[model samples]
Target: MTTAYYVHVTIDQGKNVMLLDSGCTQSAFPLKEFQKLLFQFGTQKISHQFIIADIDNAILLRLDFFENHHCLLDFQNAQLKIRDSAVRCCDSQGNLLKVNVQVRQDTVLPPRTERFSMARLSTKWVQGTACIEPADTVPGVLVATTVQDPDKQQVHLRLMNYTDREIRIPAGKIVAMCLAANLTRPAPTESASHGQLPEHLKTLVEESCQGFSPEEKPKVQALITEHQNAFSSSQYDFSKTNVIKHGIPLVPGAKPLKQRPYRHGTAQEAEIEKQGQSLIREGHGA
Candidate 1:
């Protein structure tokens, strides 16, 4: 079954009417309506702003005072009201320009239910002469689970991490991960041939590698190796060194190398050559 409702809107000034579907977020009427209303009522503008709320009971938008306008909405016998002061408008455009509108609804939500499931195991033994009877199944550990009730119309979320690790994901990081997973097209197979990293990861790596030195490449490599070994051995503890607190740096000299023009030679060797040339040019050494 479809889950939506329609709202009928009317502008009392021009006697104009409109039908708004459930999906409609905003609505507006022609300017002439406000001009006619103001002329007839002899009022500069209508007071009381209006708010539009969705079926889920979320405020969508608010319309301020209506200038050169009369009543903004006639809810077709619905019990909606505008509690705020009226919107204002300048004298320009004959005060009849189209005025934007929003729909507000008042409703209550129902309660949700929870459910649970289990996994089981069984065991049996056999002797050389006779087979032993099967043992009764034993119950495993119990886990809590919650899901949105189909009958309930609301946003719900459930998170389960078996390891019991405390992972605090930053809002920006979560957004980046979501975008990365939803790329429209597959990345090129020969990305390395182009000598460029993916835009997003490249940005992350660049930001991470900034201010690193050629001499520090070994240190960065060691850090990465340490993390890899610790993780592989199941000895890594995020609570001890969180990414936000102890960030991972990129390959050594990556930042400075990126800032300078691409050199055909090895990056590490090129950096050394550039430094040597600068020193020689400055009459410091050969």
Candidate 2:
């Protein structure tokens, strides 16, 4: 039989110890343990209801685990922050705008910094939404969009202020939380070049692309659409394109150097060259 080695990670918030299984396909925590820690340290929303289910189509009953929660754990000089709050947008004054955030079930929370990464706590994908609630207390709702980074490992949230007055968001208080909404299985994605479509067009593409073949036709069409959206080249149309095409204009003091004959250098020159070679070998040459 093969030997199994496991690493234990401690979560200081609830004094919970989690097992890190390298051989396992996905990370997970016991339901009882999850509930215990969540109750002790996590914030729950009594107004919101969340339903968690299992792969066998059985509803894994859970207590109210809706409101945003943050539990920070430090490991090896890296911070592993756990929370349901995926999007946190603030202004220069540290004020967050109350806005509705809709994201895919597989959306991972954005990292705090380059050094930080999301801890593999569970394999289960959870979908959620912080629905648009009446914000009469605040001036107005801020419009926001969630953007994923080029690497696809990171995501960014950009919020635009719409109201005249500034809204002050208090520390540790969530203006809106990313709530669990739905669970989805992995499926073939659209054209790789065009990742996620704009919200308005996304719906249209989804509805229309359903009938189109995912392999060949859609990919070609998406390529065509992207090329069509590109900016038109002005050089071909501008009359001044050929006016300065041949050669660049020279500055007043700029003169081309004439080739100099190679000559034997003096002792000082040889010493300087030796020092230069030493510097280059030392990896400090410019």
Candidate 3:
């Protein structure tokens, strides 16, 4: 079991403890008395909705609160900081834009966990105007495609931790970017913009002697049609690939030696077994 950490806080003049959870979206106190829990927050003049929880601690602090208030937690030095918000936007072509996303609070993700957590989105577009897709920029993390709420600027990021160790995502780190798709498509570049889908696809093979087999051409076309949004103009970016494997090389030697297999823990063994069964089901394994 993982250990828990607590911080001393005062609620309604009563000294109490609150669990600091980075993975939590909202912070709540157990008791009914909901006075302003004073602490070092930012200058945004923020107000949080109070909710009730049955936990022993006076408050169950979450990540969103810190992000909204622009508060930074320095775990190494035991320091809490409040800073003015700094949002970023790198490129914007027509209605297609890329905006920065930051974790609002300090949190540690356990291994093999997946959840949609709210984070600070740095964009000026109003709701319903844009859709969110993964930018495939961050490494060692998985970002799922999520649409921005049309009525609000809020964005919930689907984060998945693939490693077996805890991942410490500190506040203000550019963990991911939202690929915003809004009205008014970006101006097309290259042959795809001017011609119809079939014509543009023909251009790819117009000059080549090679041709797709009649039996397989339809299937290939269907796959592209299903994800047409991913292929705009000619610059194609489908998304990131997620797979874990390592290749071992043998050295040239006069003597031969046999080696034992590497061992994995219970969790890893179960996962390997599951994947092996999957490969077999997919006819990749006998």
Candidate 4:
């Protein structure tokens, strides 16, 4: 938001207001008002000329005695003080049309003045697109078995770090979770109603499976098993390479939750957690 104030000026015996906006980069007068004033004053003659920002223009009339003449302008309530200033008129193609003498006002005031403290005007222009969805139902992560439609079945995974450290989850890890969840076939001993991964994702899962190291195969397999049981289970936890863990559920609409009080189970646990948290705050450890 930005604001600018202009003083009164008379054209053709009628009052018109002029606002100087440097952002415009050109002098402009209201075309309709200018025409009306010209008709009323019946003056095509030029009175004075001056330069404004290196452009020359003519000032045919001055309206300094606005109050005495009973002429009203757009910013009638504007308090004005006169100083030396000038303006120039230009055409659409940037050609210099004419110059006009303008009176400048010292808008700056002393620090203690009440007018300086109290006088203010503001204007705001909102400038953005709205993409916000209902807070209650936004998904934090997508799972392979989770249906894509908002009205259908969806899995909301909550993640947290209660260990007094910052954790980074690599993109590869998330991709692996998706692939593993899609690849696992139902055991013969399990029920037949459990859904299988779509055929389109089989090739992707196979390719991703080949990229896992020997040590990672067990973890991937475990994640698949846990995901299958996640709906019925109370909670799940998994560690990441960056010392952070995932699979914790975020409370719905819980962003405004306040910080929990520090719990000290024992003196030793309290000291260790305190020191660890301080180090994490200092960026020394995850």
Best by TM-score: 3
Candidate 3 global lDDT: 0.55
lDDT (0 to 1) per candidate:
0.29, 0.32, 0.55, 0.32
Tens digits of per-residue lDDT for model 2 on 69-151? 33333321122234642322221222222222222223222222111111111112122232222212223433232222112
In terms of TM-score, how similar is model 4 to the real structure? Answer: 0.16
Per-candidate TM-score against the hidden true structure: 0.16, 0.20, 0.32, 0.16
| Poorly placed runs, candidate 3 (over 4 Å) | 1-96, 127-129, 134-139, 182-286
- Global lDDT of model 4: 0.32
Query: On residues 99-133, what C-alpha lDDT tens digit does candidate 1 reach at each position?
Result: 11111122111222222212111111111111111
Candidate 2: residue 197 Cα off by (Å):
18
Cα misplacement distance, residue 260 of candidate 2 (Å): 86
Worst 10 residues of 3 by lDDT: 87-96
- Model 2 regions more than 4 Å off: 1-138, 145-155, 179-286
Report the lDDT of model 1 for residue 46: 30
Residue 33 of model 2 has an lDDT of 29
Those runs of model 1 whose alpha carbons end farther than 4 Å from true positions after fitting are 1-28, 31-33, 36-286
How would you encode candidate 3's per-residue C-alpha lDDT over 149-212 as one tens digit per residue? 5334556777877766777778766666554344445455443354335444555433332476
Residue 56 Cα positional deviation in candidate 2, in Å, after optimal superposition:
4.8
